[model samples]
Target: MRRKGSPHLVVIASDPADAHFCNVELRKLKTGAIVGRHYILRSDVQTFVSMYRRDGFSPVEGGNND
Candidate 1:
């Protein structure tokens, strides 16, 4: 998980040997515990992040450089 601001952003890709899948996890800032998790197709990552942004999560800059 990468620390952004109030929450930690974790984007986990499924096993390389299997079909491509992506899991996004939102973790609590204080305790580093998962607050929510979602399993989504790799193509939907942007849509998912957009929805979260609409719900008030700040965008993380620099893509996945962290």
Candidate 2:
């Protein structure tokens, strides 16, 4: 998994539904975008948001406005 910081491991889902949920989470952290983290819809909202910060994500309040 991404948390383990390993290159060989990938978090595989059981089906398309699971993949979609994972995609929601993955897309939140895609390309290291900060503000993007807010789009993650899940029960562990706090935990999910904290992971980004714990892994070195910066201020997520402001972003490009052009």
Candidate 3:
């Protein structure tokens, strides 16, 4: 979700890996305030969390809190 006039956007990607990647991109896209993109990775969160080993956190497979 995103709110108009907000400094930052809420990005929701398809998975944690994408989310993590998006998070980095978002920051890089804008400095202080400018065009922005937020991501929420929920579609394949399990794989997202696991494959993205950089964060040291992963979601359980087949777990759908959605």
Candidate 4:
């Protein structure tokens, strides 16, 4: 379930063999369904973090922090 007005970004490992790689997904908040996705390398993870930080993105209450 998703909370209203919360961030829609989701990051997860889609392949067991490529654990270091992750899929960055944009999901519909109401449906919890993925609307878009992109695979990213582990090294690029920091890029997203930096970008989100720059954009003032912050975790919501009860949201996953790890």
Candidate 5:
């Protein structure tokens, strides 16, 4: 998604026990921090990913942390 210019993604997991696995191999992108924590339950990940996909990305929403 980031290759397509997506500024963020909210990764989700089906199990809380597996939740830590969600972020295990992933490297934290500075842009990723803007959306706050990326880990979430599998149930909600799709909703957020869909919303951002449909609406497109806005780097400004990440706030002026710079």
Candidate 6:
């Protein structure tokens, strides 16, 4: 979820095969935040990406957790 004044974008993708566990990469849309810790099922990549692109990265729907 996002809060007021915390405007940002979160891009989630499947982790690299070298990773030790099932994980997902989460990073800011236009920022340089380091991304290598979040976790999500690899099977959900398509669902997440589709929602993200469809929403245009806005603070609604797939962008915001709320």
Who wins the lDDT comparison?
1
Candidate 6: where is the Cα deviation over 4 Å?
1-13, 16-31, 34-38, 57-66
Instruction: Write candidate 1's Cα lDDT for 1-66 as tens digits.
Output: 354344566544453554566767776666868778877777776787677667666545554411
Q: Distance from true position, residue 48, model 2, in Å?
A: 0.9
Candidate 3 yields a Cα-based lDDT of 0.37
Candidate 5 or 3, higher TM-score:
5
Give the Cα error of residue 61 in candidate 6, in Å.
Answer: 25
What TM-score does model 4 achieve against the real structure?
Answer: 0.62
For model 4, residues 11-47, the per-residue Cα lDDT tens digits are: 4334457867766666766687988777888677678
Rank candidates, TM-score, best first: 4, 1, 6, 5, 2, 3
Could you tell me how far off, in angstroms, the CA of residue 42 lies in candidate 4 after the best superposition?
0.5
lDDT of 6 at 38: 59
TM-score, candidate number 1: 0.60
TM-score of every model versus the real structure: 0.60, 0.30, 0.25, 0.62, 0.35, 0.38
Which residue pairs clash in candidate 2?
A: none
Query: What is the lDDT for 42 in model 1?
Result: 74
Clashing pairs in 5: none
lDDT (CA) for every model shown?
0.60, 0.35, 0.37, 0.60, 0.42, 0.48
Per-residue accuracy of model 6 over 1-66 as CA lDDT, tens digit each: 222344444545435674432443445545747454456565665566566557554334664232
Ten contiguous residues minimizing lDDT sum, candidate 3: 20-29
Clashing pairs in 6: none
Deviation in Å, model 6, residue 60 alpha carbon = 21
For residues 7-66, write the lDDT of model 3, one tens digit per residue: 443233444544443331222215544355435444444553444444432333443322
Which scores greater on TM-score, model 3 or model 6? 6
Top candidate by TM-score: 4
Residue pairs in steric clash, candidate 4?
none
